[model samples]
Target: MITSEVIWLTGASTGIGRSLAIKLASCGNTVIASARNQQALEQLAAEYNNIIPLAFDVTRQDSIELMQQQLSNYSGHLDRVIVNAGTCEYLDIDTPDWDMMRRVMTVNYFGAINTVAAAIPLLEASPRPHMIAIVSLATLAPFPRAEAYGSSKAAMQYFFDSLRIDLVSKNIDVTVINPGFVKTPLTDKNNFSMPFLMSSEQAAERMVKAIAARPRQFDFPRRLKWLLKVLGFIRALWNKIIAS
Candidate 1:
């Protein structure tokens, strides 16, 4: 059980983030939960004494600044910052919404980067500073119509991976989580088949346990990871499966 840490979690209104907030708070961590949805966050806080709701949109700089202020008001330092806030929008080649590319990238990529930037100072104050990002296995291989989502996570994967090396001097650990399909409101929008999909609660459970070890990277639901690994070798077959 990871205990007694001050954890700041974004995207905590629902799905994996909400589950994670409850799980961590149950383990004796003080959770500062951030999301655009204030009422949902309040509902979560009502259920958990340790969970403090701090609602803010990650994509907005002003919102991020306000988050930093609220975080400062809560604690002097943060042991970990989890960037789980994200959005997904599939593309249509026949008639694409060109602006969607920007929207998805803003939330998943720049928003994540901005959120992390705001917490770096507080993280540095901790004896064991750790940064965790909820990236996706979508980055491992291509999928039909996931152009924006895949590209954003791909950018996050590389950014955090590179950041791990750079942060070594400060002894800050970075753990990147690459999860396969997890059942959530976000994934519920998918019209295609999602093999080996698991519940958000289950995913959050796995994440909490695995992240305790602070590995350089953690990929879950081993079966999916292996499938992707095998598929990576046969591009034609992989393409056919996803394209179908």
Candidate 2:
């Protein structure tokens, strides 16, 4: 059984983060939910006394600092932080909006870094600090039009992995979550088919379980992981198949 702890979850206004907040709160943990939508977060907070909504844009450094302040209002130390906030933008190779790359990176990569920076001090104060980042399985294999999204997640994966080593002596645990595809507001915008797409609730349940186990990394929907591994192993064939 996972013991209750103070957990801060980003992107909790909807989708996976929201599902995770609900699950974690239901399990008797005090959850600090952060998102850009204040009203939506307030509505969610109304459902549970343990859920405290902190509204802020993850892409903005100033907002991140403000969020850290707001977090202190609830608890002096944070036992866990789930940096689930991120953005995705597919690059249109023919007439690409090059600026989209910067936008995606700002949110998915730099934004996560900012969150980590803000959470580090609070995490160090806790007896058992666990930092979890929600990355993507897209980084496992190259996909069409995924230039921006894939690269951003790849950067995030590396950042967390490296940070894991640095935080080892501090006794802080770092975990990276890679989910294949989930039906959420974010994925709803995708124009292509997403294989083995699971619901936000399903993904959240898996993530919560993984957090309890506290592994270095966790990837959901094993089939997708294997598929990506196979494609990665045969890059030439994959390139030909996609090109065909």
Candidate 3:
């Protein structure tokens, strides 16, 4: 029985974030959606009275501050902050450009950190504050050409895990969501096969349920989760298997 809670969702312009925003808002939560795409955000707001658009680039600290200001206009504490905003870029071994890694890290790592930092104060104001980050399942096992994407998500996994420990006494709960291949715009660009790919709606449903449980970690699709765990324990085997 998840009650209506104030939620701040990033990367809500499309894909998983957009679906999650709609799901949460429809369930009676006051959802504030953020992204650089104003038109998309506007469309989301138009669909639901509870969905408010807060457009900003997550990469900019000033933009995060401005979003915080806009949030103040709502005059309510956020029970949950979902930092779902991220970017993925597979590395081209032939080209071997560090810029590719930088692009992924800037959005996937630094951008998420900035959003959390700005939201912390507002989250602290709530009686039950929860923070969620949508990371990648690629962190569980090394994949070919995912050098940049994997490293960024791995960093985020570490960051959120550490934050969870530090915020324990403060009563601020943090959950790290590791999603397997989902059929989102982000994954649509992948040239390789994405096993057990779920739809955005399915991913959103799973995420919302997991967040309701407020677990320290949430990995979707039981079979995929088991496979990653087994592979994780046998790194050498996985390296050979994936590299093959």
Candidate 3 overall Cα lDDT vs. reference?
Answer: 0.89
Considering every candidate listed, which one attains the maximal lDDT? 1
Give the per-residue lDDT of model 1 (tens digit) for 1-102: 799999999999999999999999999999999999999999999999999998878899766666778899999999999999999999999999989989
lDDT of 2: 0.91
Task: For each candidate in turn, give its C-alpha RMSD to the true structure in angstroms.
Answer: 1.1, 1.1, 1.3
Per-residue lDDT of model 3, residues 158-189, tens digit only = 99999999898879999999999899887888
Please give the TM-score that candidate 1 achieves against the real structure: 0.97
Considering lDDT, which of the candidate structures 1 and 2 is the better prediction for this target? Answer: 1
Q: What's the TM-score of each model vs. the native?
A: 0.97, 0.97, 0.96
Q: Which stretches of candidate 2 lie over 4 Å from their true place?
A: none
Give the candidates in order of lDDT, highest first: 1, 2, 3
Give the runs in model 3 whose Cα sits over 4 Å from its true position: none
* Candidate 3: residue pairs that collide: none
